[model samples]
Target: MKIKLLRAATAGLFGIVLATAAHAQKSGGVLRVYHNDNPPSASLHEEVTIATLMPFMALFNNLVIYDQTAKQNTDSTIVPDLAESWSWSPDNTVVTFKLRDGVKWHDGKPFTSADVKCTWDTVTGKRDSGWRKNPRKEWYSNLKDVTVQGDRQVSFHLGRPQPSFLGFLAAGFSAVYPCHVPGRDMRTKPIGTGPFKLASFKSNQSISLVRNPDYWKKGRPYLDAIEWRMVPNRATRVLAFSVGEFDLTFSQDISSRLAADIKAKAPQAICELAQFNIQTQLLVNPIAPFDDPRIKKAMMLAIDRKAFVDILSEGQFRIGGVMEAPPEGVWGIGPEQLADVPGFTGDVSKNREEARTILTELGYGPDKPLKIKVLTRNLPIYREPAVLLIDQLKQINIEGELEAVESSVWYNRLLRKDYNVATNSGGSALDDPDVMFYEAYACGSERNYTNYCDKDMQARFDEQSSTIDPVKRKALVNKIDHDLQAAGVRPSIMHQRGNTCWYPYVHGVSPPQNSHYNNWRFEDVWLDK
Candidate 1:
């Protein structure tokens, strides 16, 4: 059922009157969560869905990690889960980490620095593939070398200093893995140091995880187990949640009204909606017609961002510039700068004329149309935006066609940098500026699919990554953002906000500042009895 404000009130009122069902929440119970997507490929190689794999970090550990509660403050001085403590060199190029003693993988193997070196080497393509897939091939191409100082400690020496490396280490994408296990077959017979071990996974159905008897954290992960079900149908998932068949489910399609109703009716459950760390934007290739700065500007001016935000994002999304949303208020560069760009105007005809003038100046006519394919996906939000862009482009006489491809095919095409124009999103949970800069802007960085090579920007990005001072670093980031926006390779329409709902009993669910809303550490969470 769709959520409405009125319905939410009624739900809340009714919930106050009768909710013996709420009592079911208690310690030592299995938390049934409905994941809206199918089980990812057997390999955990996809950066988007590595959390479900055996133990990237839950059982194993990382040198550093983002805190569960607070979004900022990546603690590197001490090993929160696996390592005990670490030290960095004066240049910040070399990092030495001391591992915790007596930790055992689910398979009963001792954890050591060798595993750390192997994990980094595997993901960075320095070694052969392992049981778990390597998702950070694009992000971790900078490691010069790694050393095992001893059984308990390891050190990573970078070819160049990377200030953001420590923060990247905290994220799940850069999670630590088991080196001894092979990646090819690890998906089925996975093992990790996490509180829960993968028990069984039924393709297209559900995956079950059981608590590890020898969990490192004493008497933790109070729940006996967790079952993650693949249920993409929004209405069905909500029905399951309402009926208590599923303890948690979050969907973008669910209305805010229905969320309020659930809050009113079942106070035991809370509806939370927040901005996601993502930018759904149109990326233009640098090929011929689009290569002209004037054409890009005209195209930018053609569409009304406010309308797209209203129709596609339900007015919940924020019109954005180079920087992404969940703005990371402190670290983010304000959006005010975009207002001054030549085509940043909201006027439609002005933009069209501008585009026409530019195209004509560059030698183009009705006979020689700037015909190109604007690829999109089946996502509901993408449909309206695609239509809006196509309609807007026609005004400027740019004949753009929309091609909707399967997400799998689309992503593959993106990685190959095959499309002329496309719309997509990238997420980072740490909310650090480096997540945006390094992943999206840095030259030769895997995420830079547009082949947008700018020597000046690359030089600045390199300089910025090595700077330890915050003020100087932000200034450098400002330059990078400005240059990227001016290049117009990827222009953002909006930064998406996460729309989700969950039971109140599902406490300690730490939403990522930049990734999926459902990303949470299940360790300290306990159902109220």
Candidate 2:
């Protein structure tokens, strides 16, 4: 099944496409789909935020990409995309990348090292960039310089080495932008060398994509077109799925009752894939009462993580820290360590008793209730976990009031550190420990929306970035996780199974372990005849 795509001979290839159309599968086609959120601003730059960016990213290309498969939860599985191959220096601080030749952006311009250099410099080197205010600035701040060798090759010089550099590339934010455009102007129009080209985008309604005829990969994206419709209601999306209106849909609203109903009827229509993502966590804010070790210990004991997972997560298992490391790779914490965390084993009675003892020893009793407001989003899955947590906190004489807020306001309040506790979910940047640790736990990371900061954790995290040695890097990351957990930085309730469903007819479609959203390489997906 090895096929070479020759750009110089595209007409010859088109001749073959015309010749093979009758016998082979149809060429240059499209697929129709739907989503719930409005199309984010038409920006190929890193500034815009929209689920619609997925389709646009697919049309454009990135420096590197995820190896689309099921086991992407751990690092070391990513394959190359724009950069044909790469190498690390002896100390692991410098990364030399060889760019792929003959790749073209959707606008028909050749992709080269210039675009790569521009992309990196815009996101990391700019004096006052869009991401400057983000907490995760630490992740990019360490990048010392980017060296462009030629049109086809480039290298990154780090002030210190970051082992998880590849994981950073795998994120959708790492998608390559055109060199012709300045950083500020790119926020409005995103262009890449991907499989699909943006056809049209109507905010909050629908977005369409057409097959990229000049795409480097051959025999891909079997569908002629793709349509993404933003349908907000979960019930409506499910109904649309049932009626065959969509080939794929994104949902964090997988309910046990819905799973049961699917099992009972239309069994073949539903499929599920869950990953250890931003499940729900009662992040212990490191201010005031929580800053006291005794209070932190009492709260952990008083709260039952098991009941939340069992009753609300619907039997989803809790994971310690973030990495559910798979065996046989460059990085992993292994299954044994994953199972040994205190509240990770799903032992409700034990955890409850432990909480009670800790709180009792701290001079707190059922009569002296510990009051805390639990901030939660209005989404169904989030609300379920919040309600379950509130009920469980009551068992330990903790009065947890559920303060449900709209999604936008909730995020604002979270940034302001308004609540004592809140429920949040975060997926790994496709199998890389660096994505999770750097983006979520890094002391000043933008995504570290929680105000919790540990100097030791931050220093160690920064050290791991530049440390190229595998053993040393792992040790540093593990230490960061250990110290943060001891500080009750954020209590991760469960390593939830990230789930996705598609119609049975949708063949050759698999979800990535890195992100909860639809993966980018949909070029090979075709409806079964």
Candidate 3:
């Protein structure tokens, strides 16, 4: 059965109301939340990491949102947020949105349709013409123009109809902001038409937000305020939660083992377990002997996915292509097709034996070994997996040391292509394969840390992105998934299955299957205590 929305009154299937079986809503308590990190900027137009994005989730709203309260099958559907309703042209090239009339910015400024037009321009890199580092600007490649039609309507002209344009709108990168404020100004102080107003913010520490007194939707945002605390160390955060210092910790902020601790100690807390699209991956840069295809294939054959699932996820994970297996009925390679790929053959012993043979043939049988460092982020969760990867590489005569760097340094090295073989995490907020391919694997894409540039891969990615028909697109997507695995640049480790917890009284929050930071329904969540 689908998890019903705790409150479903203000909006439809997209709305949140007190579900018949859930507790009645209460309106005036402060919700204390524990998070992993603080954002470099609260504005939507910035390099967004899951760590940095968690603390400021309540301060902004996207034009379109993936409905978290919807059933697993329909969860990715585009729903109203700042945009109340919208329509597309007969040719599908133009999308026109009718903005909600009564919405007001946190400063009491009327939120006109022009803000929508300007926000898109900022995200697409039109607002800051020479600034090239907008990490998510590539999401709007199909946009030809955005024009304000009237006081309440705005229209978007696309270069071509992207079948999954809604997926772009639903991304956290698509958070809408006021047209009046300078984009840089928003980095320190943000103002938006969301459920909360930023009361105080300190980078890398904590953020506090108070209820929007005149929030567009009446009688909503059941909590009066929120205090989001950033607890970077995993063990420290678990201790804080156990001592009743926190009300909730979203998925990325907590690991599986810690969740079990919460369930045991804080037995009254509600722990929700689900698999999100986040994946652990092994990205081996093609340098020195790594450039040899045999070495690449051998590296792919070294690890056991089932073991990683047991080690990291506690057996709650799913292993598949670059994308996760679709429990949401989204198009993805089935189990049999997944087994035929290079690294996911379902038999760890057989794959390891073949891997050792390849390494032995290349004159590395442990006496003279292939040594490299597996660079990973300093987080315990990531380091734990990196150590396992080193152990796996040992079976194939590859001696490795675990190198842990801070988050900033870790990402900079990847952008500079300075690492050899690294264990990393990468995935799309959207279920659509086009979103994943364009963001991560497309040639010269900023997120393309592996330096993978192949014309055949590009062609397959492009064909799928442009195909509007679901059936035709699914065929191309499955083919691309197979080719990505067959080429062996980055091998999917496992789709992370972790738990998020909240006090039983923290009602109305239903996290999305993917995009842990995307669908922030904090406005709908309230405290019954």
Candidate 4:
């Protein structure tokens, strides 16, 4: 999973044909896109799903961003966006950035180092006013403070040396917010120094973004405007796309099956399939019955992970522990290593037999089945796997009724810990351990929807985060991955392999390979039509 290896792997996996400048890069067309659901809000800091990132990411600019031209994104590909340049202290505990001059927010407020300090202060809970839900607060847990030296100089002091700190800032979710704008106002009306500005947002209907004429980057954001229409039904959305209603599909929203159908219906479209590194997982609430360790173990043992892969992806997906597996994943363990983890072995019959025995010993059987509702988002990606999970649970006398809710409602339920069992997916913005472990699995993390916590595991998380040596840190990550699955801490079913397709006219775009969160600021996207 070295940088070179990851680049080579992703280059082949992405299968993208970069739009060349052979033809004059014509501008001024509205890039119409199909959104899967109505996003809860436009605030990236408060929401955790791609529902918010897809349409709203263009409205803001990160301090640093992954190279837009690269097919694969790694630490090496990180490039400055708002910041002109940056330097790290000799001890590596403090990093400073020289901000770009002449940058102005859409509201015409001058962008400065104070804005950077205000942004991190809001993110890390230093400011008096805070976001209602800072889902990624843990990403900055190592930061000691943010200080401003002058209008164009900002520094971030860390509690310890974190190698992946810059990569976190490069994430689409890591866009810098303005000092004058509060989090409440940002949820609906946001102002940023990006290539696009929000023109209109109609609840549950559509969002429109117009080009920023005075953007810092000159003559960029080739499209005059971007439009997203909310289409909750997958079949209806695909049908609309095939008939030339939408020019592009939402990032990582199309499945392989849907991609094939689109090609058949609209042969002129371009499609690319790759591992999104987002894992579909099962989360058990810390309520009664599930509070018992035996029940958790039995539930994990009963799950047939391969069945999920075979049925869901037509056997195109890969199975792994908490981290994404092998070549495509930098910190992920190999298949050989994953085989040693519990509930991951090939002997499905033996695993299910043990699961049945455990349930019987706990005084539950087919005659008196244990009934529970399986909660999931009302999207096909989540609903389909949830149905499969329920069928698998029947082997252990666990009767699960699937309860799929809207995207926003489902997330609210997860935050409130209001469900007994749920099937959900966790996507990492970066492939680094610090971003994944801290945000998703660390004790008391806002994104830890399962409410699973272990003091020892948290200590391991810290150890790996601070360790600068790649060799040593990877060993620690591997151990943590194994322990998570062995302890049934939100058992991961499979890593998804999804597709992104667009009409050939939609140019200068390549969906990120390792994550679905980055490379979305469509500054270079121009329609040939």
Candidate 5:
């Protein structure tokens, strides 16, 4: 039902609220959290999943950061991190940031504008030696060059004006890397100027981050350390949290049903439910039978999207297009408009009938069913929806076998186009069109796992990105979303509404309303107990 934010009403049981400015912050306690899976790597730039961001985001600082104190992150709430101040040139094509002096990397290396240049240069492919994979390189396609004025000043020259450029810098993945650290080393041993330092990252065991004592920000990172125990199973993670084994649950890791179970068991636990703006989508690879446009169209027509929301999320999730649906989302199409988009009509029976008819026309029916393996990540969130997708495909004579893989192997298989059909989740760091379209939909985008590239749609993406007027830009964005659905480009099932619970003793932690990525820097988080 489009839940923006729902908190447990029994406040007296906990007797404590999230730490406000007036509250006295307590420090010197380890915030033990349950991590869902082992991340592919520690490098934020190279990875797409929240597995990496949930643990490692605190280990680095961006040029700008979303105000951690804000309940919702907006353009106005973007505050400085490493950059003391920023300004734009006359035409808005060039933006510059004045560095924060006395800031040092976790390893005690002085932070400078050159490090900023090196970071973006590595992202934009100016330097070849650093990055193993530039997944979000398309996020900086408009960037002409990064020029350093001095040790403290840096300017980014954009080929065209982008209104959301500042927001991009504030994302967790946009953390500025140290110039001296090689990209390969970043995957395991990384260095940054954030409030926390990675003490150790034992794969499949735990990730430990200690407070950066030499952190530039004064009297910050109140917690002594943050420890994330990698527990692959969701039920086990939730069970442990209910019994006070963990101070906090992973970001958006708890389902609606699981939240209820936690409340029943641990009555004092604070549960915050909201739409994380992450969508579960079906990625259809261009293989022999699936390569045909008619086959793709039939595939899109077959499933029931509403069943996913009802069964998996207990009617808490919302059916949406590529962009997150409105209210929480800034640029998404409304329900009326989204219904008109192909496969989103909410008429599952009618849609499936059309799909079956198409299958029959293609000489496939109950006698000759299309057998395929539906690949999904070996996690509850991914696997559950995938199983539902297989059930729905059966209506149209598609015999689907579920193949769940590890997070690392799953991402690699998608990168190599190693699956015929897969169900996965796509998350955007920012709600802006530039970030969403370029990273996931654009031609040659590293994260474009489906390899569905339309030249016309790419041109339209640029048009909306360059359009300065909000109304005009939104119209263009809606058109792109419509076209994307019509073409069946990684057809989105539904935007997820997940729950995250934490004990009252954990203070100053703000769960992001729009994204699962940002607001994770636990610099201000403290332990009241």
Candidate 6:
């Protein structure tokens, strides 16, 4: 099986599918899913928020996509989708893709190389008026140019060789669209060559999608249709799920406490646990006292990460910082190495004592405490953690005030550096170090909410990016990780493990190992009932 998807047309592809379908596979059921938030735009590229990606992932196809079939903690394996196959030039700076022929957009436009070029150009900030914001443009920071080779072929000229370039394209945000479709128009109606086509989308109501009969891959989209509704209240959503109104809880969005309750209510439902890269961190803002390295050290030492795991997840998750920190994570510093990093050790009492000393050195203790407002999302998951953070800060004589903001405004406030201290949750679809470092920690990164801009770390990022050898790159990444912990731009709280529940009747879903809820493989899903 030489990964023959590109040439599957001539290579007995139908035979394989038919053989697989023989295993009690009967299609035609509408999957009723739920997402909590109604998105401002239907396009995945426009906003990489989980609220949007949760529903629209099934409605679009990327150039290359993760092999959802891969059974691993992190499935970095890439497989062809919109692009039939691809090859790289000798220098590794130029990569070319062969588009899948006969694929048509929902609007009946032929899927071609132009679509690939246009999508990349827009994401890389080549277009101005149409794009809402290119938050993840750093994903293509090395991309020099995109050229259409022919009707079905395209080439990407890179300024430098990107080891994980294909992985970037495989991300859910990189889905392809008709080149002629304006960004605003695509977000309005939402059109793609995916298995399902958007039939209707209403703000804060419902999103209806019907199976695309013209899908290039035959016999796919087993579901006749998909109905996505917004249920703002998690309690109501879980109630509906227990009574069999919705098929599954939106992947990884439900809290562990709620998951236990859901399991008690619907014991018949299957609960799948996935450990993603999502981590809650107290972002040490770059404003004033936080800009002082000593204050950052004090804050980092004061918080107890294990308590967060013990309380929130019932000790079911790992505690880590920056890149993931060991056996549970990938390419990160192992425990022995991690012990050297600040705030990673398990001696909580000792760390807190040191934190008190540092706070006292800054000329304040319990008598004259340092009072600050801590901003958090107005959601149960975030608010609970923020409360814990306040308690932890109180131990160090830091009088903390909690302010909960709506989810919509929470991120914008962080992006604008509006808050002095905020507890935020963030995750990457890929566990790749390059993706984490550049987007969240690099200099001038819009996504760097803490406003951390270390030129030394930035230079190291470039070195690791250009380094061809994995061993050398790993060394650079470790050094960078150590520096990040020292800086305490964001103090790691705990990595979250999400338990997504689905009815036994809903079959063929492989839970995503990565943090992305969009990685749910709906194309292979079919209802047993």
The TM-scores of all predictions, comma-separated, are: 0.84, 0.81, 0.91, 0.95, 0.95, 0.92
lDDT by residue (tens digit), candidate 4, 82-145: 8767787778788888778899999999999999999899888888444789888999999989
Cα lDDT tens digits for candidate 5, 61-100: 9988887877676677677778767777768788878887
- State the C-alpha lDDT per candidate: 0.62, 0.61, 0.74, 0.84, 0.85, 0.77
Return the lDDT, model 2, position 114. Answer: 82
Stronger candidate by TM-score (5 vs 6):
5
- Assess the local accuracy of residue 218 in candidate 5 as a C-alpha lDDT between 0 and 100: 66
Error of 5 at 477 (Å): 0.7
lDDT of 1 by residue, 37-108 (tens): 554443444445323432223433455545455543333321244655556676666777667677788899
Model 4: C-alpha RMSD to truth?
4.2
Q: Return whichever of 4 and 6 wins on lDDT.
A: 4
**lDDT of residue 198 for candidate 5:** 93
**Model 6 poorest 10 in a row by lDDT:** 1-10
lDDT of 5 at 499: 86
C-alpha-based local distance difference test score of model 1:
0.62
Mark the regions of model 1 whose C-alpha exceeds 4 Å error after superposition: 1-26, 42-46, 49-60, 71-79, 130-135, 187-189, 251-268, 288-294, 326-329, 342-349, 359-371, 381-384, 399-401, 512-519
lDDT of 6 by residue, 1-529 (tens): 1112222222145337445764676699898888777676787776757777767787789877776555443423567787767777777788788777888988898888877888888878786538666678887889989999788889989988767677777777778867777778777788888888888899889988898899887878789998989888878898999888999777776667778788898889887787766778888787788778888788888877778888888887676667764555666654355576556776888998999899899987999998999998876667889999999989888999999987667777877889988888777766777788888988877888887787877888888877777788788888777677766767677777877788998887776565554475467788988
By lDDT, the candidates rank as: 5, 4, 6, 3, 1, 2
Candidate 2 weakest lDDT stretch, 10 residues: 1-10
Model 3 Cα lDDT, one tens digit per residue, 378-474:
8766788899989988888889999998775777788898998899866566666767787778887777889889988887777787777677878
The reply for model 6, stretches above 4 Å from the true place, is 1-23, 73-76, 255-257, 334-336
